[model samples]
Target: MSQVIGTVLSALGRLGMIGAIMAAFGVGLAGTIYLSLRSPEVEVPDIVSKDRFDGEATLRDSGLNVRIRASRYKADAKPGTILDQSPRAGEVVKVGQTIAVVLSREPKEGEAPAGRDEDADDAANAESSRGGSSDTNKNDNQNRNQRSKNVNRNTVNKNANKNTANQNAGNRNANTNRIANRNANVANRNNNQNTNNRNAVRNIANVNRRAPTPATTPANPAGNRP
Candidate 1:
């Protein structure tokens, strides 16, 4: 009986020692896990405008993880370039914290180029200026044509009026000449009629003087002799 009790007690004692050792090991493991969970804080670096691969490498070197929040088209930035970051540079964060970043991509088809709006406006203004000048020249040509037409019309009218006045003067002179010729014809007819009447009166007077003297002397002598 005494030997059996000794064996049982020794076995019990060994079991208690093993339990204690196991408990100690468990506590040490728990402490190590808690310490590891509490990581050191670090400052965020400036990775904007860097290449995506280079930025990721930089973040890894700083004991940080990267998260691509979005991608967008950029005219000036190269494709796969890092354009922005959250929890910006110099901000303190825990190690292994994730950084959100925006990456650049090529512009889609039909997208306009950046910084060219002013050039387009300048071109449009130049075209408008040329159009205005062309319109002005057209208007000037029209005015010149109208003025020339007016001058030609006035010249034609002046020539017509001068011809009419000359025709009227010619008609008046012709009428005056006709009246003078008619008066001269009337005067010549009157002079010829007066000369014919005087010649007839002298012939009658000569015949009577030559025939009456003989007849009157014979009558007076016969009256005295009978």
Candidate 2:
């Protein structure tokens, strides 16, 4: 009986070791399956300032998806160039996670590519603004000149009217003075004629009164002498 118990105990020990080994292996397998099924973490690559197509390809190779967040004009960046990216470079992200990026495009229709000279674009824009300002100033100057000319013309017209009015007033004054002088001369001539007529009438009446008394006395004496 002792030998049989020893043998059974040894068998039991072997079974326990095998079961422990199997359990450990099963746990390891289960852990490996869970890791395989779940998405993995990945490092985000540097894509900023790179071409959009090239960066997209790089992101895809890194097991990431590209999400275009926005497209805008950047004076410093060329057309279709990547300007910025979310979850920046070297940051840990899950595999297949979307990397939102901002891209650069042409500022206007038919704009040339800004290859590397960002200052040149700024200069061109500044020059255009200056040109527009110059045009506005030129138009303003023209309008001012026109307004000044109109004012001068109006002043000249007013001066001409004033001179005409003064000349008319002078003419009227001269005519009035001439009429008064002519009336005074006519009145003096009429007064002198009236004085001469009164003197002649007085002389004729005196001569007749001085001769009539002597002639009547001579006729009465002649009748008495006969």
Candidate 3:
């Protein structure tokens, strides 16, 4: 029993030593990873100005976020050129720390120039509208004139037809009068001829009446006795 108890105690001591070594190794590995993640940097060389460095990309590459606090202008540096930074360029900031940037616009000109362009576009549209209205009015006048001319032409045609009809009726009346005159003359001439025929017949009958009547005897034997 004493031998078995001693063997168990030795095994427990070996297990505790192994756990301690594993814990130490884990702590050392965590420290090495933290140091490796904090990449070293050189003072930005003079050739590459701090202003031109892409702080946004640099921050994101280091697993950091970007936040903007405030912005200011400096004439010596280009408008967009970073005049100053929150965490100076090479500071060892935590992975989640943010970097902010400032953008630039034309200093002298603002939205007024855009407004002027809009006004110019509006003026152009107004002029075009006026021109369109003028064209529409001209077309309307021309159409009205054409309609008037058509109406005149139709009226003229109607008048001409009326005059032609009147002339035809007059000609028909004249022809009827001429035919009536011809028929009256022919009737008078036929009546005169009939009268002359009746007179001649009467004269012939009178002459026959004035002529002597022959006396009839009984017979040839009777003529010797007379």
Candidate lDDT (C-alpha), each:
0.81, 0.81, 0.62
Candidate 2: tens digits of C-alpha lDDT, residues 61-144 = 999999886676777778889876776689787788788877898788876644536534433443353344456688999999
Q: Give all candidate RMSDs, comma-separated.
A: 39.2, 31.6, 31.2
lDDT of 2 at 219: 59
* Candidate 1 lDDT score at position 118: 41
Query: Top TM-score: which candidate number?
Result: 2
Q: Sort the candidates on lDDT, descending order.
A: 2, 1, 3
Question: Which segments of candidate 2 are over 4 A away from where they belong?
Answer: 1-132, 206-212, 217-226
TM for every model, in the order presented, reads: 0.36, 0.41, 0.38
Q: Candidate 2: lDDT over CA atoms?
A: 0.81
Higher-ranked by lDDT: 1 or 3: 1
Those runs of model 3 whose alpha carbons end farther than 4 Å from true positions after fitting are 1-132, 214-226
